[model samples]
Target chain A: MRPSDIAFRLYLVALFTFVFLPILTSMVFSLNSDRFPTVPLGEFTTHWYKTAFSRPEVWTAFGNSLIVAVCAAALSTALGFVTAYTDFRYGFRFKPAYLALALLPPTIPLVIMGLAMLAWLGRLGISGTLSGIVVAHTVMGAPFAMAICRLRLSQMDPALEAAAWNLGASQWRAMRAVVIPFCLPALISAYCLTAAVSFDEFIVAWFVSGLNKTVPVMILEILQGNVDPQINAIGTVVFLTSMALVIVAQLLILRKTNA
Target chain B: MTDTDPLVRFSGVRKTYGTFEAVKHLDLDIGRGEFVAIMGPSGCGKTTTLRMLAGLEEPTAGEITIDGKRMNEVSAHDRDTPLVWQSLALFPFLNVKENVEFGLKMRGVSKPDRHGRAMLWLERLGLKGFETRRIDQLSGGQRQRVALARSLVTEPRMLLLDEPLSALDAHLVIRMQGVLTRLQKELGITFVYVTHSQSEAFAMADRVVIMGHGEIAQIGKPQEIFRAPKNRFVAEFVGRNNILPGKTPGQEIVVAADRMQVSASDPGEGALPAEFLSEEFAGTGIICYFEGPEGVELKAQVTEDQLENLAPEPGQRFWLTWAPGAAHVMAGT
Candidate 1:
């Protein structure tokens, strides 16, 4: 190879090592025979993986994360689909403001929104519950869903729905028949993205989840106390699962955009 | 004028957007089964009139009646008139058969019957084997056929087309003209077509309504509108013409321009011609220009064969005459 090509390859290798070295280290340490995460290299073992799975607290946290993710994804995607459709079809005054509001959550600082949600939910007697966490995740996740759905809705053939209406389809029927089918891929991508965001979210979940511990919050708690290698084992699992979810979401979005 | 009862009437129909009147004080009567074409420049209310007739738009002041029944209050779905939009408006997701059967399904027809009718329409439109084909898989012409099948399957009382062939290529537009004219005659359904092309209107319509500046400029058969226009706008809009000013006597509109030719049979007592200035040979005919004493040029289309007999050259003197009744009077700014 040429000298430049060799340099470029070395640069790529350095980049990957910088990003993934800690993750690899964590995985290897999680399989250590010893209890301490970083004392010394020991014989390879799977005890931490087993210990992490046997813990009831871990399972409860995982269950709470799953519930919040599912509820947030469902609510955000549903509301996004409706809002995008309305924005596209019947434009009104302050449309720009509504669109800006929908996009604000993703750009703003998460801690501020999390604290605001906590205060608002406390006033409404809805804080310190699984429902509150779900609400917080949904609020944060909606901007992503709305933006994706709006992009898809704007690209759809407006004449198709008009054709349906002219052919005797009622307004709702036209939406169901023509608009929904065309927008299905966008809807799926938005759902996947919202689900991933809700599942992996930490800061907002920490504020809103109160007594209900999510997987991320539980992981943080474990990391603060001891150098248990089980944290590494569970972190590896989350890292892999999140990687898979993100890859799936990207594939869905790419397929939808190409289609 | 032939029938006393107007099959479809627009009684003082008008459409206004804020201060701009898209259509103004329009009154027209279309006979049953008559193919009428509305022609105008863009934004001239021809399309607006057709949309009003189809109930896609409501008039600002007047009422529209179809077959003697008031239609101003009816929704487009209940109006029994289908408008073929300028964009073909075929559902991209639905296959040919489903798109055709959409109207039937919405009207709650039985599955078997709706399929049967849809198939019949597809076959009639020469798309028999393409029932399962997606819209994107079809050619431009084929898509137009599918659009027509979908509209006709509803069995509308009158079909309204808004520049339906404007998107097609030149050859396809000509082909569609034949298809549309034949289909209209074969089905014997009333058709209200809107177009900006006078050639298409002349080729298909039994009567052509020419509009300008949101008002009816003239309404007549294509031949009448072509041979004798009601006003300058209609004359300029319908076909190629060379307009000349003339004074009307009791029985004659005297042409005193030098760019005209008159037969000896037109007596000098009623007709006058100044001098022929120039001549242009236009294949089958010649257009001769005349400059009058009033300093305005006049023109006449004379056959090349007729010119050979007269042996007329530039600056040839002749008289031009037309009977008083031949010219239709009109007013415009």
Candidate 2:
């Protein structure tokens, strides 16, 4: 191989190793029998996995996270699609201001957002509930969904919708038949990305989730109390799930553009 | 016009966006089964006019009627006017048959009936065996045919084409022009085609409407517009001509380059002196360039016979003349 090619390959390997080493270490330590994660690993065991799965709290937290993620994904994607379509198709005063406001949630500090949501939801008497967590996650995830969907919508040719309308389809029908289908790939990717974001969100859930604890919040609590190997197991699982969702989203976007 | 009653009429139509007027107050009439082409430079409101007629845009201050029925409030879906877009706008996700069946499906036609009709159009457009192929899989010409099929399957009363052939190669554009003319003739439907190419408009339209600055400059038969333009703009835009200040009152005369005669006779009074610049052999004839008085550049197309007879050379001076009736005079100097 050429010297430059060998150097480029080495750079890629180093980058991947640097990025993935934390997750790989966590997964390896999850399988270790040692109470505390150490340099020289103890005997390998599946006991922590069994213990993590056996806990009812873990199962409940997992279910809560799934529900919140699914609901948040659906809500954010729908809101994003509508907002993006409107922004792309219409001209109005203060459009930039509206878009900037829609995007503010993702740019704000998570701790500040969490505190604000806690205070707001407390006044509404829904603080620390599943609905509160879902709402918080939806707000946190929507900016990302809207950004991706808006890019796709902007790239689309408006003539397609015009063509549909010319062919006897009403505006709504044309959007349903043409615009929605054309934006489907981006929408699906947006949904997956938002689901992953909601599943992994920690700070907002920590603040707004009252009695109903999400998996991330529960994981934070467990880590605070004790550095149990069980936490490592669940962390590895969560990391893998988020990674899978992100990879799927990227693949979908790539496939659509290439097609 | 065969039908005395107009099929489409625009009475005092005007459209504006913010402070920019896209279409000025206009009046026009289109008879049934007439092929009308709107031709202009870009941003001259040709496409905007077509869009308004298709109900894509509503005029700010006027009424449009089709078949004597007011269309001011009718939405695009309810209007039986289909448009063929310049980009073709074929749905990338749908197969050929589904694309063609889209209109029928929207109208709530049953599956079997829409499918049969779509198939017939596909066959007619020479896409019979390619019904199930995805739109992205087709060639440029095939995609254009699919777009036409999709629009025509609905059997619209009038068809609007917005520079549909602009994206094709020159050879393909000519071929498609023939196809479009034949299709319009066979269907006997009013076809309002918008294009920037004067040749395309002249070749296909029964009457050409030339637009300038969001307003009609002139509307006439192709031959009339070419041979006898109404003004300096139409004269310059429609055909190659030399426009010069006329000797008569309130008149600017346009003389075709090929009709100017070069002679060695004594120059008469008011005969403009000119210096020969260059001559280019343009396949069938020679184009002689001259710098005339007042720095006005003049072009003359000399036939092969004329070139042989005169044998004009570079740097030669000659008096250019033409018959009095050959100059087409406009109202303003």
RMSD of each: 5.8, 2.4
Candidate 1: tens digits of C-alpha lDDT, residues A1-259: 9999999999999999999999998988988887775566889999899999999999999899888888999999998888888798887889999888877887778889888988988887879899898888888888888888888888776666766767777778887878888888788888888888988999988888887999899999998987688898888888787777677777766773412
- TM-score of the first chain alone, every candidate: 0.90, 0.96
Predictions in order: lDDT? 0.81, 0.87
lDDT of 2 by residue, B1-333 (tens): 337799999999998988999889779999889999999888888998999998999999899999999998999888889899988888887999999999999999999999999999999989999999988788888888998999899898788999999999888888889989999999999999999998899999999999887888889999777767778878777756777788766677888777777665536864556777888886548888887778777777888887777677777777777777777777542
* Candidate 2 chain B: worst-modelled 10 consecutive residues by lDDT: B264-273
Q: What is the lDDT of residue A164 in candidate 1?
A: 73
- Residue A157 displacement (Å), model 2: 0.4
The regions of model 2 sitting more than 4 angstroms off are: A1-5, A256-259, B261-273, B278-288, B302-315
DockQ of each: 0.36, 0.69
**Candidate 2 C-alpha lDDT tens digits along A184-231:** 988999999999999999999999997699889899888899789999
